[model samples]
Target: MPRPSEARPSGARPSAQVRRFTPAERWVHRATAALMGVCLVTAGCLYLPPLAELVGRRRLVVTVHEWAGLALPVPVLLGLASRAFRADLRVLNRFGPHDGVWLRSALRRRGPRPAGKFNAGQKLWAAWLTGAVLVMLGTGLLMWFTRLAPLLWRTGATFVHDWLALALGVVLAGHIGKALGDPEARRGMRTGFVGRWWADSAHPLWRPGD
Candidate 1:
C-alpha cells in the first residue's frame, strides 16, 4: 500500500478560528463608510464648479457616485439584522433629563459634565444621526430606483437628495474632525470596547455599574 500522503490537516486550528473581525467585518465596516464618504465628498464638490476639478471626470465621478451610494446603507442594514446591534443601539440611544442638564451646563460654559454612559450632546448627535441616516437611505432609494416614482415624486427626491447631501457633508466634516482630535475616542469604536476608565470618565452615567 502506498504510504499515507503527508497532507495539511483537514480541520482549521482553534487559533485560526479566533478572529477580531469574523472575516474582516471591521474592515468591511470601515470600507463601506469610506466609500460612502468618497461619494458624499465628490457629490458635494460637484455642487460648485470651483470644487469640480478636485473631483474630476464628470461621467467617471458619476459612476463612482452612484455605486458608492448603493454600497453604503448595506452594512448598517446588516448591523440592524443583528440582535446585538439592536441591544447596543437601545443602550446608546436612551435619552434622559440629565442629558438636558448636561447640555445646559455645557452651553453655559461649565466644563463639568453630568455623568452618564453618554452626555446630552452625544445623545443628541446619536439621535440626529439616526434620523439623517434614515432620510439619506430613503431618498437614496428613490433616486436609485427612479423608475418606481412618478415625475413629481422623482423631482422631490432629487431636491431632497441634493440638499441633504450638502447638509450632511458639512455635519460629517465636523464629526470626522472631532474623531481625529481624540486618539482614545477613535479607538473605542474600532475595538468595540472603550477602556473602563475612558467609559467612566466620558460617560459618567453610563459607567458599568451606575
Candidate 2:
C-alpha cells in the first residue's frame, strides 16, 4: 500500500493552478479593446459612404476617430504601473530561442511546443499592434493638423494611414478569431487564473514561481 503521505485523497483538487494575468493586465486589455472598438466604428463612419450617410455627421465622426486613435496607448501606459505588465512587455519585446521551435511546431500541428508565459504568437501580435498604433497615431496627427505638414506629405500620410488601417483591421480579426476559439485563453485574461493542465500543455515552460 502507498504511504499516507504519498497517497492522494479521492476527489482532491490539484494545487498546480497558476496566475496567468494580473488584474491590471485584464483592465488594460478590456480598456484597449473598448477604445479599439470606438476607433473601428468611427473609422467605418469616416471611410464608408453608406455609413457616413447613415451617421450624417462626417466632422463629428472624424473627431471621434482621431481622439480614439490618440487615446489608444492610454490604458497600456496606465497599466505600466503594474510590475507584471512591464515584465510581460519585456518578454514580448524579446524573442526567445524556443520561439522559432514553437512556431514551427504550431505550423506542423505536431509535438508539444513548450512556451513561456506569453507564446511566440502572442508576442508577435503585441509587437505588431504596438507598431501599428504608433503609425496610426503619427499619421493621424499629421492628417488632423493639416497645416503642420506640406500638401504632398499630408497626402502621402493619408494614403499610408488608409492602407495601414485596412491591414490592421485584418490582423485584429485574426486576433479576435484566435481568442474566441480558445476559451481557456479568454478565461485567463478574464479571471487572471488558468488551470495547471492548460499551462503545462500550452506553455510548459511557465511555472507558478515564474
* Number of the predicted model whose TM-score against the real structure is largest: 2
Whole-model alpha-carbon lDDT for candidate 1: 0.64
Model 2 RMSD, rounded to 1 decimal: 6.3
Clash pairs for candidate 2: none
Clashing pairs in 1: 115-205, 116-203, 116-204, 116-205, 116-206, 117-205, 117-206
Residue 2, candidate 2: how far off, in angstroms? 35
Clashes of 2: 0
Error of 1 at 9 (Å): 50
Q: What is the C-alpha RMSD of each candidate to the true structure, in Å?
A: 13.3, 6.3
Residues 15-132, candidate 1, lDDT per residue (tens digit)?
Answer: 3211112223454457666976887767866677877877678877777777787767677667766654555567658867777778888799665566465567766776776687
Among all windows of 10 consecutive residues in model 1, the one with the lowest summed lDDT is 1-10
Model 2 accuracy (lDDT, Cα): 0.84
Candidate no. 2 TM-score: 0.90
Q: Residue 52 CA error for candidate 2 (Å)?
A: 1.4
